[model samples]
Target chain A: MPNTFAVPDYFVSPTLLTRARTIAQEHASLAKRLATDYDVSAARRLGELQSTSTAVREYDEAHSALEELQSLLTSTDQELRELAEEDIQPTRDRIEQASAALKSSLVPVHPFAHLPCLVEIRPGAGGDEAAIFAGDLVRMYKGYCARVGLRSTQLKYDTADEPTHVQEAVLEVDSPGSYGMLRCEAGVHRVQRVPATESKGRTHTSAASVLVLPSIPTEGGGDMGEASFDDPKSDYYVDPKEVKLEVMRAGGAGGQHVNKTESAVRLTHLPTNIVVAMQDSRSQLANREKAWQLLRSRIAQLRREEREEEIAKLRRGAGAGKVGRENKVRTYNWGQQRVSDHRSGLDVRNLDNVMEGGEALERIMQSVRTWMAEQEVLSLVAEEENSQAQKK
Target chain B: MPRLAPSLLRQARAIDVLLPPLLPACRDLRSAENELRWLKDHAIKTGRQCGLAHSDASLKRLVARRARGEPIQYILGTEYFGDLELKCQPGVLIPRQETAASVTHLAQQLSKKRKGRPSDLHILDLCSGSGCIPLLFHHEFYAQPGNEHCKLHMVGADISVQALELARRNQKSQIAAQSKRVTAQTTSLAAMRFLHADVLLSEAANAIHAPIGVVEALQQLTNTRPTPAYEVLISNPPYISSQAFRTTTARSVRNFEPKLALVPDNPSSAPSALDGDVFYPRLLALADQLRTEIILFEVADIDQAQRVATLLARQSTWRTVEIWRDEPGATSDEADHVLLDGGESVPVRGAGNGRSVFAYRGAAAAWLQ
Candidate 1:
């Protein structure tokens, strides 16, 4: 059954073709009965025919068209041959497009697609360069958000020990559906650039990781279509008992005021170990509130990822192993001025423009979206084949 | 300093005497633990240069002082105020979170005009200790893109020469360290500098208005007042009354930080409750003298802020005298005549509990609307 619905590769599954043929034949008889007897029951049966088996009707129409075209190909006249040659391609394309559209529609929409997102960027390997690159990525996102009419706010910006680079940053892109748009950006982003600290001209590899999570309200992931973190009823709500809160003076820096004032709050979810430390606010309460909001989003993201993994494992067996396939997504090479997205396997030049978050960045994101759609369609087709095979 | 090495965290954990255990509250223990981690990191970094023994002795002294309630900022000799990492010294009071918040709010309102600022934006910070307010504002303003062309002419004015020297040192280090981080490369020709001037004196106030004693402040001071009718006037002036400072203020602050930066000067032998508010009228007079439009002051608390607003109401200089707060009030805009700016938008700096007073005219005057 898994290989049965490999459409056209094996002339559609015999079982599926037979099913469609049976439906078509049944529909023909019901139509004929309704025309002759003129009974309401017969008419109703005929009316529901297309709805019951869409594939059968489409196959019926295309089969008949192909039969007529096959006959035309055998005609002696040159004009008839030419006409068949021209008409055959478009008809086939129409059927393919229609079938794909139908197959894709069968798959449910991603649950978190409509929700806004928070993107957490952190340094991975390369020391100062990695931190600088992380900061660069933050700027790029903020610029891109500005260009796209999305309000991007920095919730937390942890300065590095080096002081020049940001150690960590959380940006909330406050537009609905940004999660779907930015989720593809999750994974490690590699940068190849000659360090300013480097004396000799040589390229060094550095990496920054982007973790995109749906911006759930800290209180509740409400059914009201609005997420609030304060709502105990919210799916995002972390039980107070489950979280350990820690308050410290703002990092050892920021003068005596930052040192004496215990303003920084860190929230550690016991089960998940997802810790969100916030010290930007001078007040402990404010910091705690921010930490909760971040923790909720992160935990919600973690759960969503787990769910995706489950779906991925199913899709891999049922269709293709695209889910849980890859993580290293993109690379920014400064010397060559190239940005290559591994997901789409697209190598785009103008690294600076991409860093500026211009059209090149959009193009790369669009390619990721297109690639995602194809994977989704493939998985949906596979799932349909599995279900249909089991019925057989 | 060195990303708080594991050894440092372990070291802080081992100590029970100097590093007190934080309460379960998320705000308490983390900072103390964090500072120890940084101190260890700094110690390691210093050790790299001067050997372990040299680092050990100095670190021991710093740690011992911290145990005795000396601020870690003074020990580390550095502070991150907003976007800028300013140099900290003993005489100059460290920049408060309340000041950082008030300055942030001020910068946002001023930068709303963005690129097409009529001319250069002139800001004057009175009682500017460590020059943290103006220094941070300069750095934060330029940190964002599209602010490359924003000519932010800044002046940090203080009465204490020590503060002025410390402010200059902060200015120098900030430029040295954060020059690459921000857009304003060298901070224009004479944009960022410190000046010595007492706001309490009309003689010093006249120094800015007429061509009188401002020359002396200029001959002596590197920074001066700019021409375009000072649009923004900000201060974290001393507002703590003697009674409140004695009771409410922390022992760490009382023992270490300068008193000049926290409380007002006594005009008479016996200081009254009104003595704390002496700067509000002087600042009001200075604002009136210079035609300063937007004004923000960091008061001790909401009650003191309310009194400042009342004092502001007496004068016709300001059209709106609003108190921006973080706490949830009964209403959005209050009957108390203080406008509530920045509702849930930008986080307010006060004590994280609404306490700063803002008096203004011109575009920024209409905060709530």
Candidate 2:
């Protein structure tokens, strides 16, 4: 590939540059509107676009600095050329940083990115071994949360007949901005290992699917603008009529007659057929509240993905060979003591470190996050390119 | 109760050693596992607070108590009612979720109708076991940002001294918890009180006639000059019929919970009263004497709710009577009206089997909207 001075390896493409500039313009207009009217949603949108605008300004300065360095590089004087040579590499680095920032800033932030998240893990394939792998994944995520200093609570942990096997589990990472951090972990995770239950030494393949959903704020919504449950237009809003609640009180009379400790609560979104059952807490009220919160998060995530899919369809081939929830995004090979992320194509030899949610797991997660950001940027560029083509 | 299968016990054993003990009370492997997990978590939490040895001892004691079919609320020492957690004792009736849901719905309605207006509102809770109804109502009502300026005088009355004591304790703790969260608004938690009163004798009692009447008790507790008229009268009195108590009531409830809070004490005295319908007539008479604007009576089921609603309607004091279900906020696809014994029909609200009978006077009919 021929190296171009204008478009470096980390530099933003023409389409992405225009996208960033447009976002900056939008931010400016929103700020002006907010100054006069003080609309809440508009102000929120302005806050969201703040980083992109800042990135655009930084990229422009870096571009100007590079142009100045380029002029100095073409100077006749040997001293000026040498001086420029020294600053040229650092200027290129600055450009690279600015462009990278600008590109990511152009990628739309997830609506629930600032909220805490729930990580749901369920066995996917290979029966009892898969259940055991699911248990491993649960511990791995829990360990990762601990190492990263994120407060995590096991919202629901159901165990199979086997002590070591996990029927299903939900781990709540109770910290803001966790959705942004752990959303990349949502997909099938395959493990190649010899089962403890296996009589023979033959290696077996098993899988566990991980789902990351934003945990809606219980009381004060914090910064969760339209995601408020009361807002009918909000993705979090499920019409009360659309949901069927089942309290696991034994058949017959309720109230004081039943001192039954079965405080399980199940909520099924009728339209979506998404059922969320919670029995963790002894209080039925608490369980119901938690069930609703989980149900809303799941519905919100589903709605967001559906909208994204529609947009992705419009910009087809932009996310070519992209790993979805159905695809195995990662694999932990116990035989080779390796952990690999398929999307980012990163492989590490330290299996124990990954299982411990150590530096190796962080590296893999970071790589996947970067890969996801790149995908978003590519699709954004494709969208802009198509719109521009239509203008022609 | 049906005997637990050996397989279920085996599964419970697989989950945890403590789980099999909870299987008796929990009645299933899943809930048993959940209870065990909660108990273990509670133990660990207590271990952090106190020593690990103390935690283990308490966990074992709690598991043993639960195995004997004691309510977890009693073992845990607290029960959540709406947003507030009330102290639960053995003799005091544990706050039921259906009651919480009804109270929450009523509070929401009252606050919504009030619309940030500062006004004196008095609520009378008859048979207020654990003082869950009034405290929950206060918590749910005052939680709305603008409602802090509103003057709330709530009195929870119960026949049992233990129930009254528990109710007062719940009120004090809740008031302390709420005072910390009180904004710039001057909210008074002092107005809420609990008193001893036999609501069964409410028919013959009046402010002047009987010193222990519901009205006189309200006056003594609230100390309002000229005796304030209650805006809302709410109760979750014992409504289960004696036969139903023997046949339909859960064994755990029969074993552990207080019968004083489950079945009305006497059914022979009132000629017109069925065993379960005994409390309604007395509560209605009390409501009429107090001139309470709204009344919410928690019933055992639809049949009981109908009986109460019919009784309230026959008095001619209430303008409209409605039946509410387990979840009063939930939407239902069923018919909005349930036909009474007479040709007249009453509007029904929410979902599940009818849980509460709601009736309001003409003055407070607007609040129902």
Candidate 3:
């Protein structure tokens, strides 16, 4: 693997660090209580003594209580540590961006904060090779998920016919900081090798694109102003006359009905010509509610796209063509056995090890943390300069 | 239950008389009464059975044993398992009621599904601790009053020689009981055999070899086959995780069990080994090779069950998997703890949620298609 980048070190704010230290101290106290008061020590002693029946029963109960307490403490400690580590920066540009946000009095928002992430992998220009590469990418992400204790659920997939494997697959991974870690996975991944189906020893190049979308929060409206919801501006509605509601027997992935009755409902929005389907509910009403939420998210996404276009048109006069353009995040060269992330300018030489899902990814996560810290510091400098100018 | 013997009842009354003045812990009247009754009966019965005369010394010793928390069954030297009396020892695991229920369920299913006479049946019991499973099957089907034509061929395998010996003794006792019941017209025949083999070990290397005694016994029972395969395979293997062992109460780990019978024999030294639950993968591999029609294995909990089911579903061999929990008797507190894949809680019918058993059947290609 390539050597990880070592950016300038930054310390978290003293207030946050102190809070984390207090939390850790509280956890130590709780652990001591669990070991002493819960009879964990007593249980170990009784096991040695081969004690009376009452003693044995007491020991079992005490041990279980201690185990539960320990698990709770570990989870709490992890949360505290993440919060403490939130104050670092490694780059001047990111620091300046943070300073600007603070100057504008805008609340800081994580790109994928508090939302389940949707990861999409699709074959690009490379035909069968791209599809096969996409399949490999899914496995890599799944392995990464296992390492991080994230819960991954396969949302949907389209398998290639006979000769090739998976053409496209989508997964929803739920965990703390999952989207922030996986956002770098977006863009095209390239693979070069002789295809197994190809008889000749000629090398072929294939490409697959990954799209990571933070799940739209249904409860918290995301930048959707009042105008988007008002009925006046080209209102779109599902025509009841043209719409059809179908209930069918639904089963798990293997396609056999787990239940005898047709409780699943599929709703087709007539005006936008969009179909929303849901089946994992016991009652029809529950299924309908799920379908409606999905429909709302779809409509919101369309409205957001239109709003972005209008904003871009207005920004054109400002002559800031480079503004708002996201970077080409990462590239994997299979033949050279190397992976390069343009954002951090870090290169990992062992592509196989990185693809196998190991510590190589942690290097990237640490760099992101450092970059975020740098952004904060630059913002602080900009604010200081602006205040001085105002005073003069 | 029968009332206590008169002499035993008198001894109990005496204990109750002395307890109030001596120990304040025994001040509770109902608790004192219960202690007295338990001590009196336990002393009288175990003393007589162990060939000790009905003397004051014997009574005191028996009472001391009871107070020390030794299981009553161990003091008695025998416990009833099905229709046979099994020799109970300190090292051997006790024959649980839930296991008995599992066996009964399997037998009922087999009887309902199978056609023709219940003869020519082949059964294999792995991890056959005291051979109670095969012996019970024999007693139920072969030694029954009217079931004469049933020809049962049973092979019980365990890794421990001591356990296998105890199993043999239990089998012999059952056979002796059968011969006594048989009249001049009917002839009693041997139907069960015991073997000592470590199923976890690879057969290529003789690292953990099957005991010669067990091998010979199996050959005799099978009439010359070195290895006897069966249609029905059942095992209650060690499924506890190493992490569970570390945090588990000493009552489970140190006092009541043997480590060899509880923990996996070997764990791969890999980073992912912590996540890899061992027994399921090995058991499934064995099932694939054996191609047994029916296989049942006990697991720790519902999470293990789901993971096992997932592993089996990935393979081509097994088609149907169903989880079976032991129904706790009427006296047990009713609480459901089994969790389904979709995060719904379902009732596990055993003593605890952890003791539930799972059953899987090999799927035919026609069924899949």
Every candidate's DockQ is 0.05, 0.42, 0.01
Q: Please give fnat for model 2.
A: 0.65
* TM-score-best of 2 and 3: 2
Model 1, span B38-99: residue lDDT tens: 67778878788775655766666667777677766787777656445667888788776546
Q: Summarize candidate 3's per-residue lDDT along A146-235 as a digit string, tens digits.
A: 887878876545554422457667777866456666655666666777777679977787777776655543343444333222233522
- Least accurate stretch of 10 residues (summed lDDT) in model 3 chain A? A252-261
Which lDDT tens digits does candidate 3 get at residues B1-369? 134345543443454443332122232333334344445566777678888777466646644553454544455455555445677676765554445546755665555433443346567787788777777766555434445654666788887878888888887776666656553212323646677666665444344444433334455666875455465778777665666555442332334445565666676663332332566676666555555566767665556656665665566455455555543321246444445565534445543333434444543222222
Chain A TM per candidate, in order of listing? 0.76, 0.87, 0.51
* Cα RMSD over interface residues, candidate 1: 9.5
Q: How close is candidate 3 to the true structure, as a TM-score?
A: 0.39
Chain B TM-score of candidate 3 stands at: 0.71
Estimate TM-scores for all models: 0.50, 0.80, 0.39
Index of the highest-lDDT prediction = 2
For candidate 2, write residues A1-392 as lDDT tens digits: 12257555665777787778888999998888788898888988888889989998987887788788788888999999999899988888887888788887777776778889999999998999999999999999999999999999988887778777888899999899998999999999999989988899989998999999888888747578778878888888889889988866555688877865557789989999999898888767788888888888889888887877777664566754434478888999999999888889999999999998898999999998888888878887888888898999
Backbone Cα, N, C clashes tallied per candidate:
18, 0, 12
* lDDT per residue as tens, model 2, B1-369: 789999988887876788888887888787677677777777778778775655777789879988998888887777766667778889888888789889998888787767433377878899988988887787777777667667787788887888888888877786676546554222546667788777876443645534376766766765875666787899998888888888888887888889989888884764433687788888887777787888999999888888877777678777888899888877779768888887569988987778999877766776555
**Model 2 deviation from native, Cα RMSD in Å:** 6.1
